[model samples]
Target: MNAINSQKKHVFFRRVSTAGQDIITQEAADLPFREKLSDDEILIINEIATSANKKAIKERPEMQRLISLVKDKKVHSIYAFDRSRLFRDFYEGMEFNDLRAKYDVQVIYTSVGNGNMPASDDVFVEGLLSMFSDIEGKNIARRSREARLRYPAKKFGYQKQKETKRFLHDSSKSKGVQQYFAALKEISSLDDLYKVTKEYRKKLKKTDEQLVSMATDPFYAGYDLEKGTNKLQHVTPYISIEEFLQLQRVNGEFFKAFLERKKSLMCQNIYTPCCGYCRKPLFYKIEEESNSSYYSCSSKLHPKVTVSFSDLSKIIGGILSEIIQNFNAEKLINQSINCYRTIKKHLEAEMDSIDQNLNGIIEELVLGSDDYSADWKQDPMYKRKQLLKQEYHNCLEQIKENQNALQKNKSVIKVIEEALINQSNMNPSMLCDMLINGIWIYGDNLQVDVFYFDYLQEMEKEMIFEGEDIA
Candidate 1:
């Protein structure tokens, strides 16, 4: 159907696939919706992974915009190629349906019929269709899993059968792996192995998985054996299969445990893309008493620019206080006033009637005898108790919301102030996420580039334009 007022109504489309499939490709495979809307009308297409549950929807930045438009009823209709494109899981599908039905939103399947489609399909039918679709999707997934299990064992660590052996054993590609193992064999202690490997990994920028995989894979020993596939190659082995398996058994266990630990630390710490020193994208660490964790230099672990965890935490706390102090109290108060005005506008008509009746009752009481309890007790003004209670509740809610907003603004102010203070003690971990854009640490010095602090500093120039006096 032709979309009237298309320029004003927003439209959204999404494709969910883990294989990095773009809308262009997906559209080629399956037809997209036909829209007679203007080219200027806003259309958003998000690429998401279907394997990841609906919770993963938050990762797509466009999802938030879609949710806002739905919530505000700014978008009159949402169109997808099919129901699966909208949602695959039953619960997530129900959520999408609820949004459409509750908001009077139209969900149109682009590949299906246009406005001619039945309006009487009903929610229950939609729900049943979605459930069947989910079951079908799960069946397809099971078939794919079975197909993957049928791949040759020789291709396990070597390469996919679809991919060539030349790609796997390419001399240049295997050089780093070969060198790492050669070095590993030369090492006598775990410390030396760690140090050497750490330096090598830094130079290679290899992920933990790649590094661990290279260390454990027996495919390099003329036998390709991994979780799903195993095979034997006619080529000469780099190491015996027995030896390779033994080393993998021992080292694989260690590496797996190490990865778990690394993941845990990452979750606990605030690792920023910005360097603390030099405002570059690097982080350092200072591992003092074995158990204590702190950020140090990116240049080297033993760089003199290192700051202890205690010192970093203290500096951050002090900066936080300073930031809080600099908050624009006048601005916050004005925001509260605006909130109060909005609420007052909503209640003004009711309040006016209440005031008129109240005044009339007061005048009547004055004119009547002091013992005129019967008239006062049966008054129409007394019946306004429920309306007054509603008004009181609305006022209270607005006030609470305004206070919460003010509190949030104050917190941001605090973070800004703490960032500016040149404190000796700062917990690089705690303040790093809040204040730091990047930290660059070199041999003997460190530089911290704080985006929030820098932005506030820039705003200081605006005061002059506004004819505001500086303190």
Candidate 2:
């Protein structure tokens, strides 16, 4: 659709990847775009407490609505705090890119500054984010996992070892399991088995299914895999291994078997020539109806453009690993510290300048020999003095704010340094933010920008200007 075919209004969409993240941070950053919107001119879509990390853009309801609007050419320009908020999936990026291109929609990231764009315009971020989710989830999961390990799973007849994550026999529950299994073999009448299992179910507070599963489980026969940990090599079996195997051999002998059971780079080190035809970045996506990471370029201008390597994900993974290794865990942390130090020095200089200005204002307040004492309250000098005093108060408040920010930065720096030094585990998002500039696609080759630091200084300036709370 052409410009005449679409509405000339902006859509302000802000979202957090996880529920724990505060959207207010995004709000503070996008004030420049937000303030300009007339009520009818700007459509505000708040996806607060929503996670683009967990749900694809297609799965998100608000996003789906916005997509529909975009499809209808009802939107003119789309404004978001970061591209990450819009998409983290490769295909989702392609999907959105196609829509944006086809409909003539402009995508603007308001938070990008000093000519620095968001690291991942669309694709690599999803995986790296998934990898971060991989990081955060594992750490957090291990904590919860440890807590659960302290007790047995709701499974009958076993308790977990706190430290080793091993299951120990709970005699009371195990007795019920043993009784049910023994009955399963000895009892001939179906009705008799029903009564026995029902009584055991009530006594154990387990359903019939649980009792049957226990009997069928090799755990009762001394071995079975629980989850990710390990299988039981030794156990007080309710029956022998032979019996467990025999039960499985006969289809009708045991209950029916039942079973049940989702990563971009973009700009600074990232560079993309505007598709002059479109705004989407290097697209690495999979074919539909499949859950594979196949690479493809979304550039219509170069329809034949294709990634030259196999397993682009692996290549990206290797790149990420190498980046982390080259930095030696200390490099990124040190760079971050230096950036904050630069900011601190700038703030200190600002405070000193304000102090000097206040001092001059005070000197101006002192009366000259020609001044009349009675005119102090009635003359222009009085007005000037009041203004000077207001200025002094404002300067003091600014110093206090800058001082508070510095203090916060110090505490954060300590925590960051300690985390980097002790755990030695680097967060993927930080690596992407502080280092991976962008992944730009040229006509035939894909470029990965590994060192992007100019924006860090720009970021410091933004923090000062916007009063961003680092803590």
Candidate 3:
């Protein structure tokens, strides 16, 4: 007992990919202690210190914790029932070897009882085990992908038949799916569909990409993901194949138009401007029959308030004309440039500080002396590190925004000067993009706010117009 105490390590690390009832009976929790450690060794039983999931990814938090423990000399050795429990890939195996060499940490496979240092034969055996596990994982993924092609899995509007395990249309959720697809067919754009199905959006909360993917999914039309001309009409379909094809075409056009319009100035500010009554940003939609664009509030309480794009242009044009006549354009441009430079300098300095702090934290982590407590999630330094990362990204975004604003202001000055010189031929779209910040509509009244590039005071001028009299 005294000799065992002298030889036994301070800490023993144990890991298993599975811990619940599914684990093989022979490789249970007690087996590791029985086979691997002597009576004097102690196991590290902390939840954060162990990984028990099927995922063999190296980026897992549990794996990181274990690595940290080894690097910090908190654990002298790691014990697993099998080599696969530790790693299943050659890259990870190589990484472990490097860690072992640098830190003198022993990795023991209890089932085989290989000693302190893995000999040349033990290294070869470990490599083979990792290679086989990797191959098995890949084979499982390939089989699963093939199975999906043969017997496609149930999707949004489907359920499996209990008796046969085949997919069928679920009556309970089919109504909503039908209505959604039907609405997609009628609407010209996602913006129009979103306005029409505001209540449904509240329930589903699907993004534009999700909506598009759902609408275009071939499974609704009784087709598989595999490339085949013949339709698989075995199971029940919620939507007709013909209708589904038509919706796909319509969705294609909607996306193409959306992409084109997103490049325009009005689309950029459409969601930024808010409704005075409900404080919800206005959404833009195009009329199918009249081919005219209109902006309306997203709030259900104020659905009647809407303004035409042309009317908005006219109202905003008058404001810009007033500004051109009253303000000195050259002086404003120079002031904006100077203001942008000052803000940019400040943001860059803050970014440098954040980078320096982040580097310090990373260096500490590399040296295995990070002051971050074991409860890293709750540690103040860990929280500060996360905050610094977020701030760094935000600062980058602000710098980009500032650069864009400076370029836009310069463009505005050039366009305004040209418009003043040749008043007959002015591009309203260009002017709108350059000067107008946002527009708010309330009942029949509209407020247009223009951006002033001067640094001295609040750089915005608001003009009110009655919508009924605009035309």
Point to the candidate with the largest TM-score: 1
The sequence of per-residue lDDT tens digits that candidate 1 reaches over residues 374-451 is 766565645555465566567667657766776676676556455535332344455455655554544543444555
Candidate 1: residue 131 lDDT (0-100): 82
Over the stretch 341-424, how does candidate 3's per-residue lDDT look in tens digits? 999999999999999999887666557655545665775666778999999999999999999999999998888577764542
**Candidate 2: segments with Cα more than 4 A from true spot:** 1-7, 16-21, 48-58, 110-471
Q: Which ten residues in a row have the lowest lDDT in candidate 3?
A: 45-54
70-176: candidate 2 lDDT, tens digit per residue: 87778888888766667655456666766787888888887788453644445465345434534554465456655453333554677756676556678667776
Q: How much lDDT does each candidate structure score? A: 0.55, 0.57, 0.64
Off by over 4 Å in 1: 1-55, 61-79, 108-128, 131-167, 182-189, 202-209, 217-229, 232-241, 260-283, 286-305, 310-471
Comparison by lDDT, 1 against 2, better one? 2
Clashes of each: 34, 10, 0
Model 2 TM-score, 2 decimals? 0.33
Error of 2 at 56 (Å): 5.4
Q: Once model 3 is optimally superposed onto the true structure by TM-score, how far is the C-alpha of residue 367 displaced, in angstroms?
A: 60
Q: After superposition, how far is residue 25 of candidate 2 from its true place, in Å?
A: 2.9
